[model samples]
Target: MLLVTGITGHSGRYFLQELIKNKYEGPIRCTVRETSNTFLLDNSGLKIEKVFGDLNDQDFIDRVMDGVEVVIHIYNIHHSPNIVQTAIEKKVKRVILVHTTGIYSQFKYASKGYKLIEERISQFKNDTKCPTSITILRPSMIYGDLCDSNMSKFIKMVDKLRIMPVISRGNSLIQPVNARDLGKAFFTVLMSPEKTVGNAYDLTGEMPIKLIDVFKLISKELNKKTFFISVPLSLGVLMARVLKILTLGKINYIEKVQRMAENRNYSHDNATYDFNYEPMSFEKGIIIEVQEYLKKKEGSKSK
Candidate 1:
């Protein structure tokens, strides 16, 4: 039996689908918070058990880990560390912890909540008493049909405004990994215990592209004309403050955009060499995302 946390999230949902597609015979279980909407996984043809529980509650963690052998910890909230500790206590030896690249770079400008979560993850790794063999998987800007990530937001902004707001020079490079590829990599790590235990890998797509090029690709895919508006760093900060004042600022997204504009590149060399992880090209991922977006748009128009 395998327990998957964050089952409603982008990577988690795709991971579940991919496991089913590959004909995985193991029983799967997932945890959802009180308010989580998990109806989408109900008829997925896999033996799935959805348990309502809070990650912070030790008893809830124990209940969720009962009869579970391996656990994929993907929830990025305040109680993540507690949940991981509980998984270890339950004798769930193999655990995969999915983190984000934001932990490395975006923390500089992230809200206190984000900073605390990152700190907890680091502390959990440092604690030797936790007997679980953990593999930390960090990915950057994951995108797929179900994702409304930075890439998707960029596409929508381009569609609406016909212009992209470049925070600075827009020369910073980013490697956006497809959600499906990220799922595959997660499964591969979980399956190979000896090779992945206690190792951390940074995952990304096949190519590292500049921010401008990324927007250009989306524009091309959507057949939309794009104009680049270069906003100075100081002005970008000021605009962020203004948005926050207006109750319109998404701290995570704003911080990530600022970081990318300033250049934050994660090396995937370890991931590629260790697990033979090869992600699809950025262009291919964008094409698939565009097609899915178009389908959704058309469906909504018909309604």
Candidate 2:
């Protein structure tokens, strides 16, 4: 038996889809809130038991952990310590935590929390007090389908603009891994826990692209003749600070402006060496995502 969480999220949905596509013949269980949309998981290969509740409830977690051998945590990284504790108490064999490489961002509280979770999970041990087998995957900025608030959101924002806003030369690099590729990697780890446990890997895209090139790709995909509107990072940050003051903190643009100047580039070669992780190029991935987004838009309009 296997238990998973965050089945509605971008990466979670892909992981589930990949598992089903590969014919995972096991009783799969997942957690979801009452308001979670399961439409993405309508087409499933395994029988899934949807456990309804929040992660903070220990009783609910204990109940969900019944007979579960493996736990794949795709949800909140903050609750990782608790989940790891519960899984340990339940005598679960292994836990695979889906974390993010955004820990590199020093200003992000969420990223700090993720780093804390990693530390806590690393300290876990069984009744024997030996180190527990845990596999943590820190994925780069994930983008795929409409649910992604990263590059997919970038595409939407770019489509809505005649001139794209950029920081400096917009040369700050980014390597965005598709949610679908993360799915395959998760499956590989689950299938070979012995080889994967007690390790952490950075899951990234196949190529590192400049932020400017990303905007170009979006323009090309959307068939828009958008041009760049360059802004110095310092000035953008200052404007954001002023906006924050004027809006009484209702708006804080400094973060977004500063983020544009960051280099999010990374390598997934370790993942490839570890699990044969192979992802399509950014061009192919972005095109596929745009096509899917358009298809969904067309479907919605037909209704």
Candidate 3:
């Protein structure tokens, strides 16, 4: 039996689709919150046993971990150490941890959080040293349809506003992978544990492109050109901090702006060489995502 976490989440949704589309003939189980939306799973007609509970409950998690063959952990990296320890105790075979490429950011707070989790995951992997193999994947900004926090917001902002807020020259390069491709990469790596186990790989898009070009592409796809007003990097940071103070951290102001300032470009040769991971280009990926966004927009209007 293969168990997955966050099956209703962004990458998890894609991962489940790929699994069903490919006709995976294994007993699949997933951990879902009691309130998680299951429309994708429900509409697909795939039989998945769901363990409804929170990740904080170790006993409940242990119950779900029982008799599982491979575990695909798609959400909540903070709980990784606990999950890995539980998996070790439960004697599970293999575990795949889906992390973010934003961990590589020079921004202090975000870097610290991701680094701490990565360190703990490494510690657990070293401690296991046996039947359990933990593979870590750091994927770049994942965007598809309206489910993403990055490009989807950008698409909507561009669609609604005449002027787009851009920081600095928007020359910083960003390599964002498609949620579908990231999902496929997750599946591909999970299938080949021997080669991917105990290894950390960065899964990114086909190529890195300028942030300005990304906006331009979004404009092109939406068929609406917009003016770009460049704001100083320092000013942008100040605004984010101010908003955080105002909202009491409800905004996550730092990550939204600081990440855009740093170059998030990465090499996928490691992921590809390891598990034949091939991600689509941002151009095509964004197009598909935009179409989905349009569908959702139309859906809301109809309702």
Candidate 4:
């Protein structure tokens, strides 16, 4: 039996898709909180057992771990460390932890609260002594259908306002990987335990490009003209704070922009060498995303 946490999330859903496509014979179990909606998985051909409980509760964790052999820990909430601890206690043989690349240096631009979370994750990684084989995957910005990350928002803004926001000189480089590719990387690592265990791998797109160039490419794809405006970091932070005061700042949106402005690079050589991980090109991912967006817009118009 294999357990998948956060089964409804971006990467989790991708993982499920890949698993089902490959026709893995093991039983799959997913854990979700009370507020999480599982309707997304309805009618899907994948055979899954859903466990509803608070991940922080050790008893609940044990219940989900019953008869589970390998576990994929993707539930990155406040109780993530506790979940890992419980997994160790349950004696699960293999565990794959999907961490964020932003948890590295990107936290410098994050809000105070997120920075603390990053610190805790780092501390937990350093302190863990579990006998189970663990592979920590740190992936860069992930974009795909239904994604609302910085890239998606920028695409929407370009379609709406016919302009793009460029922080500072817009020279900061970003390696945005497709969510499907990220899923494949996760699946590859999970299947090849020996090469991945006790290692941390960074998964990123094939090429890193500047923020300005990214927006321009999207604008070209959308057949729109983009007007670029530079905003200083201090001013951007002030604007974000003001937006928060007005309840207008989207939690993940502001944080993503701030992080992108920092121009951090995540290496993927370890992942590539270990599991033969190959992320799709940025252009390929963007093309797919734009097509989806267009289809969605047409559907909305028809309705």
TM-score of each: 0.87, 0.92, 0.92, 0.86
Cα RMSD to the true fold for all candidates: 2.9, 2.2, 2.1, 3.3
Question: Compared with the true structure, what per-residue lDDT tens digits does model 1 show for residues 1-303?
Answer: 899899788887777777777777778898887787777678777788888887767788888888788888877745667767777778777778887776666446544665677577667667888667767788887876637567788778877886577877678888888888988888888778888888989888887889888888888988988889888877887767777767755442456446757554678989888888989998898889888888889899999
Best by lDDT: 3
Candidate 3 vs candidate 4, TM-score winner = 3
Candidate 2 regions exceeding 4 Å error are 39-45, 108-110, 125-131, 296-303
Model 2: what TM-score?
0.92
lDDT of every model, 2 decimals: 0.78, 0.84, 0.86, 0.77
Model 2 C-alpha lDDT per residue in residues 28-122, reported as the tens digit of each score: 88899999998765657478888889898888888998899899998977778888898888888888888888877756743677667666776
Clashes of each: 0, 0, 0, 0
Please list all clashing residue pairs in model 4, or write none if there are none: none
